[model samples]
Target: MKKLLYIDANVNRATSRTERLAQALLDRLRANEDVEVTTLVLEDEGLAPLNSARLARRTAGTAAGDFSDPVFAYAKQFAAVDEVVIAAPYWDFSFPALLKNYLELLCAQGVTFNYSDEGVPTGLVRATRAWYVTTAGGYCGDYDYGWAQVDALCRLYFGIPDVRRLSAEGLDIVTNDVDEIMADALRAIENEPL
Candidate 1:
């Protein structure tokens, strides 16, 4: 079975519209293939950003090719997955800081990526594709910074070329019907090919 990593970052998962949409996508994907999903609920994982002391340890571990530390768990897991799903709500034109923290942890050298002979980055991640899901209160037309950043990192740093963005936007628009819009988004997820 394919190992699929699902990173959940919805702040209010029990009633989060973003979470519901992502679950639908997950269900559809599972129906089409045999997948073993490993979910990392960001809220449950007490992840911290890299600090001076943490950076020093990370550097030492990477230089010595010894990632036995618990800090390397996220990076190692990220590199070992065959597919990825990142679900976060759009806040202030980008994703929450918790997702950023997780991404920071995943950017470990010699773990998720490494330098080539020419000093260029070559990804070590085994994932072939990643789906970024987000819900926005307003239209995410030209300023979809969250998706843009994720796509760039996947391609430029992680060597994941098949990055796809799935979003449900304008849910809070007074003129739009939230339920109707959500149903349409569900249909889109069902019809979208894996």
Candidate 2:
């Protein structure tokens, strides 16, 4: 079965615009393929914080080999997925802290990516496409910050060329046409021109 992992990094625990968009896109994608959706709700899940020991093990080429540790298993699960979707609201010009921590777990040397001959990093995840989903309560003047980081990870580091983003800005502040803005965001997601 084709695996699609959706990582929810919002800590609201109620509802989030980015989460809704991700769900809508996932429903659409499910219509065409036999796929399994995996959700990593970072707020509820008890994920180990990537500390110096973990980082040292990862950099020292021992994290992947530490089969007894469940972190390795989680990293392996991410590496084996066919597709990935990250839903994180724009917070202080970037994604949430939980999402950052999840990414720290994914930076396994011999797993998701590796070093090339010239000491350049190369990704191993073979997803045909991936997405970065977010929403902003204000104008996207500072939006490039988060998208740029995600792009670097998904494209340059992870080798996923088809990484796309769906965003809706000024939803909370722009009350004149809030529904219209949301509808347009949904339409944009449906007609993703990536």
In order of appearance, the predictions have TM-scores of 0.97, 0.89
TM-score, cand. 1? 0.97
Model 1 CA lDDT for position 57: 89
RMSD of model 1, in Å? 0.9
Worst 10-residue lDDT window for candidate 2 reads 62-71
Instruction: Using TM-score, give the best candidate's number.
Output: 1
**Which lDDT tens digits does candidate 2 get at residues 1-194?**
89999888876747677878888888878876888999988888777678887667666565345534555666677778889988899888887777777777876777777788898989887676888888888877855577788778878777787888888888889455778888999998777653
- Candidate 1 residue lDDT tens string, 47-88: 889999888989999999999988798999999999999999
The C-alpha RMSD in Å for every predicted model, in order, reads 0.9, 2.1
Q: What local lDDT does model 2 show for residue 137?
A: 80
lDDT, residue 158, model 1:
95
**Clashes per prediction?**
0, 0
Candidate 1, residue 85: Cα displacement in angstroms equals 0.3
